[model samples]
Target chain A: MEHGTTEPGTAGPENQAVPDRPTPTPAPGTPAPGAPSSGAPAPVAPATGAAEEEHRPSPREQERERFRRSRRRRDTWIAALSTLAFLGLLAAAAVASPGWDRVHGLFLDAGEFRAALPEILQGFWLNVRMFLVAEALILVLGLAVALVRVTRAPGLQPLRLAATVYVDVFRGVPTLLLVFLVGFGLPALRLQGTPSQPWVLGVIALVLSYTAYVAEVLRAGLESVHPAQRNAARALGLSGSQTLRHVVLPQAVRNVLPPLLNDFIALQKDTALVAVLGPLEALRVAQIKADYDFNYTPYLGAALLFIAVTVPLTRVADRLQRRAAQRTRAEAAR
Target chain B: MNEPLLRIRGLHKRYGSRTVLRSVDLDVAEHEVVCLIGGSGSGKSTLLRCVDLLDVVDDGTVHLGGTELTDPRLDADVARRRIGVVFQAYNLFPHLSVLDNITLAPRIVHGVPRRQAEETARGLLARLGLADKERDHPDRLSGGQQQRAAIARALATEPELLLLDEITSALDPELVGEVLDVVADLKQRGMTILMATHEMGFARQVADRVCFLEDGVIREEGTAEQVLTDPRHPSTRRFLSRVLDRR
Candidate 1:
């Protein structure tokens, strides 16, 4: 109690002469020392100056703080220990399986995978080329369809209806069926100008199927823009096409960028379906090698190649999605 | 009076059997400031919107500066270029800078050169007290600053008539004064204005003529002093009293 009184006197010379500041510090330090001498005025000064400086917590507050700290430490240890135990149990179970030797011989043959790597890499280049060409076509086709579907002009109603039907029909049909139909049916037509190349037909089929899904995603973004914005643009004397080209499309594309990337990723994976037409894509090459060696490890090599390309793209899309969400929240707060 | 700057006769508007404006007629002389005052559903906003051709009239004619504006054969975009409109909530394009919002119409619709349009936009921005905010987006501005920028955008085209629909209704109490001051300045410059407002005091102070709308019609019309201080209609008195009581 004496040290508490002396500490305040040393901390501030003005407090020693004030009589009010020194009285309160000592009363809390030694509450049972004397009530009438210190307790009466002590409560009033501290209550008013509570916010001015940090004070020692009461026993109840100290106990609550200690409980919270220990609970946080316990939660961290429980989570970490449970994750380690789960992984260990899985590994132990895998080692003790009766079919481990046979499964390893077929699927995990490291020598067979290494032997197939060079040819799989060469075949993967074809898949990449198809993906790049199809992606460009999909962007243009999808944007055109979305623009037509969103048009409000009375004269364009027929075009809008046609675009709607195209999207519905294409999205309903599977990509593999589209590839088969375009690859086989176009050649069967025997049209003079149509190319009979399977890869070209494969690219067209991928674009046709993916454009429908991407257009719907873009249309959702366009519709989310408030109608007030359209009214403002119209009131400013901007024509419908000018408004769409400048105001509406920029905002719409920005809003739906992550979803557009997701569709492109799906397109990349679906390029493998082109193999049904006898193209030497990564998957087809892997299947041939696996059948020759009587081992499934080449399939694993093809899967790894696909994963290597897609994982970076997936990470980029996730980062962009997070940033867009953050920007939306900040705009809302403003 | 040298042909009214704007004329509306037999204007009718309805939304699926619910009539909003029924055979409304109004006239505004050049350089005159007319204010429309009404209750929530009194069709003040609808009448202004119809005059601007933002909403199509069921049956009517609107003439601006001796040119018929309601003809269905006329290109609405070309016609809209001659008029300026400011809305409640200050609908400034959120994605563009203040200067770009002001210059978009003149550069795109009127075919003004980019540098010339930007010069005019900068002058308007300076006059509106937003000289330093030319490059700032709408979300970065206060409500009053955004409304002032909206006014600058509307004035950039040098329109024959300006339509303002409750411009100060969306502003904070302190911010409302700055927006009203811009309107007062526009009136001083003799811009032809047809505005709808809920601010009774401002309407009385700045308007040359005031029209009281009630249930899809103008119930009373006169000079601002006459309609606001000594009304001829009982509904006008009731509406004013309710508005004044809240103040």
Candidate 2:
């Protein structure tokens, strides 16, 4: 929000190198380094010259600075008051409704919430455990599938076909359908080594479903890296495998971290879908408590727990996306 | 009088229906610098890629010393080990610091010890005037600085022949001088380099011999002063005037 001042190295080697010629006027459209880098307000001309350092503010300039300060404060106050008014109006409308007393007793009772907390928290650990296992397997399998899809090796064709088919099938089927298929369907087959535990079956189904999505995310990342990067690595005498390992995958993974985190957040929430099986996760526990008391407050407790974990992950993902954008913009400016 | 460090015989390359290079023959003598010059789509970059074994030539043979690099059975990776290439875009691995970018092939592909790789990388960086920027990533450096770091990287493996594909084309006009200066310095060190360039001025100054490519063929080849200023081929003269007129 301030006028430009940060172009310290005014006389770069380029200027020094061309001592015989005055600095070529930057090609027609190139922005001056002193040009405002962002959309923030700039009330003064570029501060490249030393005259701006010593010049005293005129009466008009002093008045403008005062105006800018007061305008910023007023903007902040307007934002805060508008948000508060919106939330207050929503709360007042809800409390003033005709069914407020019955709805409040059924869904917002503190005693029902307290009674449900212990069992729900205990069952929530199962959801956490299932997702953690599923997430790890998903990451490894996703990367494997991505590698298979991107590799140009002749010998891996059959393997690539299999990977492609796996991704197509899993991604085409819905996750909850996959959960049902693996949980109820797998057990019905009565096959040897089929996990008897619902949570284990849930994790497997979660892995299969999430791996498909993550694989596509990772494959896009791998393909997003420029072909020139691969040529550069190979030209450096690196084998194709070495190039993929060192140069290609590192850049691909960095490029896709935000999307990867997004998939992880979805996987974390989808863990609750395991409640369809016999295992008592937080959602199932809440279902049981609500059925027993004819009160819905326990469902709120389960929702709050899921939100508690996912919100932090959402924030982290947003931060990562912002950092990636800033990095690309900075590179483009250079 | 003596065998050249690199020899290309009847080199031909094609991309599906389009022939990018045709019957191209060139050589780089030991300690010599050869520059390829032409307009865009003139096959200059493809020739460099084929010579470096980054692109598989459709026909003919490339010899590095006594090794037939273009032989069907040849391990391309092994052949590539003895040749260094810097692309026009200065493809320094963005994820790595300048030091790591330089040391990657040395420490990983060539199996040099980490300590020794880093030492040699630092030396190359210092030589290329990027010593202080070794810890910075590619995006953190200017185009000229990144190109310098890329040159440092190509030299880390101590390749016998260096292939440069219009290394300064992507730089700002002002930044071009710095990259060209690095090439000139490498020429001074007696490196056998085959380069493609758009800068007729720099090519004339640094290249011992220049080859002009047109329509997938070499139309002219001679000393830089002879080919650039006094061309025998009409195509070469026309290309030269078009390029040299703007600057």
Candidate 3:
């Protein structure tokens, strides 16, 4: 999906700019001097020297400046053209559709959207609460599992195997199925002391599935730490646990922050999945309103709310990843 | 004269089928600087690692002040606390500020109070000419400054013996002098040290004794003047001539 968007966005500029290069200054290989050819050999040296002095900026610098200017112009044209093309396609599709007005009435009616907002907003609060609880639980569980997987002690083999198995099974099972099993199947058994609330069960399933993925991310981060750091920690007389706590885990956590945030963003969207159990979360509220009013505007409203919550979070993750890359580059340069 | 601060008797180290150290025996007295000179892959680093109990030796023994360090029953962490080591590269923790790197061992390993550890760390940093860089991370420092910070960290715990394994080998030629100057300063302060290096000039200048190692064995050992200037073994003579000729 990313490749599809970026390819045309960049290719348009290059294609438009290429023809302009060869037309002007066609003999790029030849260096032109303003020296008049003289029959006398002595004047040749002085004339060429004078010609060289007359060239204010070096040819290479001049060409580079020209290239920069052309590139800027090409970028501007690409942006304008791509925007026009995209809007034109949408307009053409709207004009060609046989039921455009009916589709618009069903999906874009402002009155239906306004009527759905209050209940959907209330439902979104439940999603927010569940996401918060699930995120915290997942972080703790993920770090514990990652630590167990990375520990090298022979005595902890059984514990390591169990943690590994937990990760594998949870990661392999579709989250939707796990949600169904935990939220619906478990409560059907009528076990004593079991909390049968849909929201609680949904949060449990989300935490279980996310912990497996986040644990693998954390494990990769732990493995990425240089062996020298561990050697230095051990040589300083720190015990294995102390070395991990003080030396390894801090660096690993920093390395994995972007991915962990990505996982949280996914969890935020997945909060809507609780509607499968008939809980009146945002999506469920939207579904009921759409069915009652016979308008899809409520579904669009719910989607917009999800986007509003996730976009800023994604931007934050991007900034963090950029900063991390910059730090590594600076370290390498040093 | 005094009981040797570190002793290795018939130390044998192997990785799978290949032996890195073969029946190597050496002793380092208190306040003495012993330099190990050899070509690459000649067991210099392996011997130093074995002494620090970083590497489990296949056979033989390592003793620190007459206590057996290599015994299987001994706790390696307790033995390692008495020995400080600086590697060729990435010696300082990049995640930590210079001061934190220096004080980590003292505070965590020795159970020193935070205030005392910071005090010692600041003094060491000042002595190493990095007093103003205490708050800076290792990545922000130049290679020379990073190495100096690493040395200060190694010295912060005041270990009984310091092991430096090719510490200057990874440094640029211009930066090598500053790190060697720190080692020379440590020697003047009478720190017991065992170092491995290819820098013959620095070794000749700073080492009290020099041992020439060839194929995991000590071919010649004596004072710096005798071993470096006039070696008895044919292999040592050839190695030194080749090294000097390249210079």
Q: Candidate 3: lDDT of A239? A: 80
Models 1 onward score TM values of 0.84, 0.90, 0.87
lDDT of 2 at A42: 45
lDDT of 2 at A261: 97
Once fitted onto the true fold, the runs of candidate 1 whose alpha carbons sit more than 4 angstroms away are A1-85, A152-158, A323-334
Say which prediction, candidate 2 or candidate 3, comes out ahead on DockQ: 2
Q: Give the TM-score of candidate 1.
A: 0.84
Displacement of residue B228 (Cα, Å) in model 1 is 1.3
- lDDT tens digits, residues A64-127, model 3? 4566577668778999999999999999999689998998999999999999999999999999
What interface-residue Cα RMSD does candidate 1 give after superposition?
Answer: 15.5
Q: Looking at model 1 chain A, which ten-residue stretch has the lowest summed lDDT? A: A1-10
lDDT of 1 by residue, A122-230 (tens): 9999999999999999989998899889888899999999999999999999999999999999999998999878888999899999999999999998997777777
Clashing pairs in 3: none
* Cα distance off (Å), candidate 2, residue B209: 1.1
Which candidate leads the pack in TM-score? 2
Tens digit of lDDT per residue, candidate 1, span B81-166? 88899999788887789999999899988889999999999999888888988998876677788889999999998898899999
Predicted structure with the largest DockQ when compared to the true one: 2
